[model samples]
Target: MEQIIERIDQLWQQFSGQAAADISKLPQSGSDRMYFRVKGAEDAVVNSAIATYNPHIKENETFLSFTESLKAAGAPVANVFAVNEEHDIYLQEDFGDRSLLNELEEKGFTADVFALFQQSLSKLAHLQIKGGENIDYSKCLTAREFGKQAILSDLLYFKYYFLDTLKFPYDKQALLDDFDALSTYLTHTENKHFMFRDFQSRNIMVKDGQVHFIDYQGGMLGALQYDVASMLWQARANLPEEWKNSLLEYYIGEVNKILPNPVDPVMFTIQYNGYVLIRLLQVLGAYGFRGFFQRKAQFLTSIPQALKNLSAFTGNRKMGIAVPEFDKCLQFCTSAEVMSRFEPLRADESTPLIVNIHSFSYKKGIPSDPTENGGGFVFDCRGIFNPGRFEEYKTQTGRDKAVKDFLEQRTAMPDFLNSVFDLVDISVAEYIRRGFASLQVNFGCTGGQHRSVYAADALARHLRNKFKVRVEVKHIEQEAKNWINP
Candidate 1:
């Protein structure tokens, strides 16, 4: 890691003619590429850029070439500033920390967020049609085009990595025949467009309120519908059915404006549905390979969502192509029995831990243990200022607006919570990863009504918003009305 950091610094210096003021490593994604955020010297004209290092030279070359093509076609893509083919390190425009997926999570599915999705799809249509022009197919990482073989590869990816792993009953030879039929049916579509192989919300970054695309190293020439399908059918996005239909129409309309001739609505719908099925299955295979086989908990969390998508798709309508065995496989995969394997832990079911948080008066003793395990964390809040000592706030509990304001503005409660977050985050994260069943966190003070209550509520909100985990908050001294469950 030290050698890699030094090399990134060297690359930054070589590119900008001065050393970077700061170079920090970025988090790794599903890909093998290592990323870094490099800031130019304090006085330099270029302030910052994203540096990427991949061990594969050929893949880097393909990405560089594709990026240039997409940019030239007026797509919203980051520009490549420098390249070191020998070291397989390159620099590109930094799109910052926000992705469409992050935006959706922070600000739910609002009109403004949906507008961004519309703009992204409009730009995607342009990338598929205009970006394909004057591009060299020989530089592609896999097949030069998404042809019959490529379609089959995705179907088989679903079969071996996902279906077979489930131990579901199916006729192997019949499924293979169905796979060939499906591939043949899909490959006949208008496929000479630039296909962003893994185009999903996570790959679309929102910088300065505009969407910028990335992670197209696996892109190749393919049908236009495939990219659209990849985006709308993204497992975790969980886009509403109405939104999906409207977005599909919106994309088709954009394609009409870009293409010399418009597509037939009927034919387009048929092909689009076919691709959606293909993409959904392909992603389930990916989730299974990354989650079940590799034991990555993050990927495992997505399996249920993907299965839900498959269920919705298969239940609504049949694909135009006849593949009875394939349909049978889909039905089996989306069945209640198969899906239960990936379902979130129910109140009655065993697994995925729930955190129980309580606020209590130290004089009255700590909250009683509710789980089979006898011990848990108890944080003392006595070091913090007591808002209850003040006359105006004496009668009010932590949930009251005045008491909340006092704790936030006047006390060291924020600092105390930050320190507590630092400690508890480690355990909460590890517990979720290991599939532990329960965790109890308690905050105690002179009285339960003020400091302790405030701390418990704050921690519960933080855990739910950050980890999407179940947090139940209780104020022991308050009435039953003060209890919160989610």
Candidate 2:
């Protein structure tokens, strides 16, 4: 560690002399690995730091390039100072002593934190790597594979501390079964994107009132929901339920602003639940790795919390189909029914989790009953279904088939008329039957110009008695307005 420190000092010397003075007060690393920050005495140049350790594997210029790209893309990545590729030493910018977690710990985040992260999300959303190749997500293993490692850890932890060390009965097969269910659920992704793979609070640095990322060598192209889940579910910074849902939408809204097309929030959430479950699995593995292998008993205490979160994910209606499998595993490992058997649990019902579904289409299509719309049932704990109506497309030449269908139903148009309706429908259903709490409905039109917007207004009008409707008459050719149904 001393030799590595000296090498890091030499690297800092490459910068201006003022940096040397500020480097002295740096914290003694909490871990065996050494990290120190060297700031410019005047704060004129830039605050910087070095992370040094014996390379368990190795580091290289390619690694440097990855970090550099992250920095350029507005990602909260440290700038590369100098790298001893063989030793895994990194000298980079020091964003200074605030991580997102730190702010939450000390002076709880103001609205500014949300704004700051929004900017960061925007940067990440628009990010496209130069030289055109996307990030190599393949290098990072998937959660399915990673979950197995967690199972092994849980098994070992149970056997050692919980069983042998604590003299408790260890159920091995139950754990294996739970892992199997978790692995399968994680494999089904509704959407995918470049992921920070491990975007936990510990890894996010808040220096100079801005958020940045550290320990990002494990980055990959994966699900967008993974980072959001990590941020919301992080042990150190567990967010309020309202805050979590709001921030989740904020991130999605930011992402949609940059994408060529909008994303389905319901679908993203379904995927998010799966990612959360995977995260729990990874946490279990990490805990096992730390507790049983490293002799750190503190991590063992965290296992139950991880299990609890895992249970929450499984019991989620969006995640219901996968829950039975995951439940079996939980039952197997803990030898106690870990998953909450009673759901729409009283706590969940009282929370009033509201999710709105928005759909739009260009052609004249009939809209589904908002009550039946996937997003409809979110209003009621009991399941509700809305089959979006659409004007039947005419197959016969010059035949008034579509017109005939519309006249028969007396419905003007359909909201969310597009190829992705399958996903949209599923989302609405899940929101009602599973994630029930409250509901809002949105209808869109191609250009929000005509059909979709009109259909949306009608549905809002139809559901006004039971729902507080926000009906938008979006027109591609004109400004949009709300047609509140009385």
Candidate 3:
């Protein structure tokens, strides 16, 4: 990987005629490709570019072709900068670290973020219509078009990856027949445009105070409905019903204005809803494959949210046609019997131990234990250097970056927490074996704004990760006012 970074930096220097200062590897996404943000020593050609190392030569070729087409059609997409001789390594314009999903998650559904959603939909219409005009189907990474076969593939993906993984019983032949029926109905729609196969908030980046798209390598000619369904019905985003409805209408209106002839809004919407069901099922299949089969904790954790979103659609599935077997599979997936496994473990009488954690100020003394069993550990954080002494972090709590950095870098907080974790682990394990219901661990500092709060939160995280026993945390000082995490 270090060698790859060196090679990438060398390539950037070769292309830009400027020495590369640093090449930092980015986080791994769903795809197998690795990425890095390459910074230039001198800004000759460009200051920063996203360096990609994908072994799939064909996929890389398709992405380059699509970007050129999307760029020509006024789509908000990054430009291809350079590609290596092997075609495996390439450089593209960096849209910065902030993606639309990052914005939605961090700031939530603010007015500005909502507008970005709308803006993305409006541009999507253009990407599908104008940007899609001259796209050579021959250059597509997979299927030439998202026709009956393609739609059926998505349904089958859900069936094999998600449904088959579970021990759910349903008529296989009948489900196939239903898949054929559904796929045929969807492909019969008049509209065919470039469909971003994985169009979600994460793929859409918010750069230069505008929305820019990434990871559209799997794009193909399909109805606009599928992409819209992918974004609005994203399990993680879990967009509000009102926003989904508004965004869909807005997208359709944009499409109508661009196209030579307007589509019937009523019919288009019905098809859109059908695609919503398809997209949801397809997503579940992906989660199951990545989570259950691959044993990825991140994907496994997301199963509940995906299941929750699927149930909302399946509960009132007005698809204008019924597939009893498919419906049965959907119902089984959303059933309480299956969902219970993903839910947090409850602390019942027979369930053994529950650890109650608290952070308080020395001024307030130790917090009182709620349970009848009152014996536990109370660690003093006053010995540790407090960031509260600094004026810059005076208003900030332990959760804030400045205070957290101060505590972590300047003080012996990490060593202190490591020792605390060792002590807590013993009692927690023994308590679980002995069927102990409660354990109270408190951290007290001068103000509870810096040291104690950080320590308590750290210990809570440690316990949650190390043990299956239920853990509860309380910041008495923060609760008295409110918490701050930034």
lDDT by residue (tens digit), candidate 2, 1-486: 346556666666665544355443244323434456555455656555654443543233434655666666566567676655364666676676767676667666668766655655555455422211345443443342233354344445434433343333445566456556654565555345555656666666776666666765545555566677777777656566667778788878877776666788887777677667556655666666665565443454466666666555555536434445335544444433432211112223333334444344334342344444333421110111111233333221111333323322333222222212323334433544464554544444333333433334334443332223222333222232232221
Candidate 1 segments whose C-alpha is farther than 4 A from its true place: 85-87, 348-486
**Minimal lDDT window, size 10, model 2:** 378-387
CA lDDT, every prediction?
0.84, 0.49, 0.84
TM-score for predicted model 3 compared with the true structure: 0.74
**lDDT per residue, candidate 3, 167-189, as tens digits?**
88789899999999889888887
Candidate 3, residue 461: how far the Cα is off, in Å:
5.8
lDDT at position 212, candidate 2 = 68
